[model samples]
Target: MTEKKLKVDLSVPFPTEREAQIACGTLSVDSEPKRGGVKKELVVKGNVLNIHFEALEARMMRVGMNSFFDHLNLVIETMEKFGPPEK
Candidate 1:
């Protein structure tokens, strides 16, 4: 079997840097402007094309693994409420 990478495209309608930042609450960490998909790997400035990688194991957390899962669920819930803002 091979490793497959999944890409998610966000359909936000913001066309300006300030609009993007205010709408999503993420500051631009880049010096130059950009548009479109980011690299497959993680980028310092998580944006429109950010990819989140999940590890199979949870080894470094103050709480137990179950607590981590619950925390993740809360994150998802927040995302759902925010409708996946570019960050």
Candidate 2:
């Protein structure tokens, strides 16, 4: 049996490039658990954060996306609570 391949791409924009970069850095720190045919990538472009995910199956893709969103939410909250000092 052949596994179905899935791909997901998401982009999130922040008020400032600094915040976007911070979120990207935090999200990139840990990689997905060793799961075959699962891949994730995070990047920052100006004030936008980009995420790409690939999985061998729909279930795996959903789990991976959920995990990413959970962490991404934390990153956003952290930036909101303790962002750079107002200049």
Candidate 3:
């Protein structure tokens, strides 16, 4: 028999499984739900909280900053789109 595996697009990852205990959490990420993913233990170099949404972060960083206000606004927008700061 063959074991089917899931393709985990870590593009969006919850802080912990506890955060996924409800629908408003990571559960709402995708309706189909990502199942059968092989759990891999990782030794993070630094505090790796929500490292999956990197492309989104890069997109935010690409915005042109004409002044301090523009940069602040962009940062605020990014925080709103992404979650809170990692510990």
Candidate 4:
């Protein structure tokens, strides 16, 4: 039997395009691990960062999303603490 594909979409808005770009760059560096059965994609448009996730199972999707949120929180915190990088 063919496995079903589950998906999730997330959008995060930053204060500026630069900040959004920075977050996308930082977060995109770590692709989802192969064993997790999840795939992730990141993109930045204007001041918004978009994330797309696909997984074979709901559990896998939940785990992947939790991990992503952890990293995203760090990125936002870092931006809030230190601001965006220099142009």
Winning candidate number (TM-score): 4
Return the TM-score for each candidate structure: 0.28, 0.86, 0.25, 0.93
Residue range 1-87, candidate 4, lDDT tens digits: 998899899899988999999999999998888999999999898999999999999999999999999999999998889966788
Ranking by lDDT: 4, 2, 1, 3
Residue 69 miss distance in model 4 (angstroms): 0.2
Residue-wise C-alpha lDDT for candidate 1, range 19-81, written one tens digit per residue? 334433332222111232222122223223232323222332212323433543554466567
Please report, as a residue range, the 10-residue window in candidate 2 with the lowest summed lDDT: 78-87
Alpha-carbon RMSD, candidate 3: 13.1
C-alpha lDDT score of every prediction, in listed order: 0.35, 0.85, 0.31, 0.92
lDDT of 1 at 34: 29
- Best lDDT among the predictions, by candidate number: 4
Per-residue lDDT tens digits for candidate 3, residues 1-87, read 854433222222334433223212322233221342223222222223222111122223222112222533454466557775554
Candidate 3: pairs in clash: none
User: Per-residue lDDT of 37-81 in model 2, one digit per residue for the tens?
Assistant: 579988889999999998988888888888889998998887778
Those runs of model 1 whose alpha carbons end farther than 4 Å from true positions after fitting are 1-63
Instruction: Please list all clashing residue pairs in model 4, or write none if there are none.
Output: none
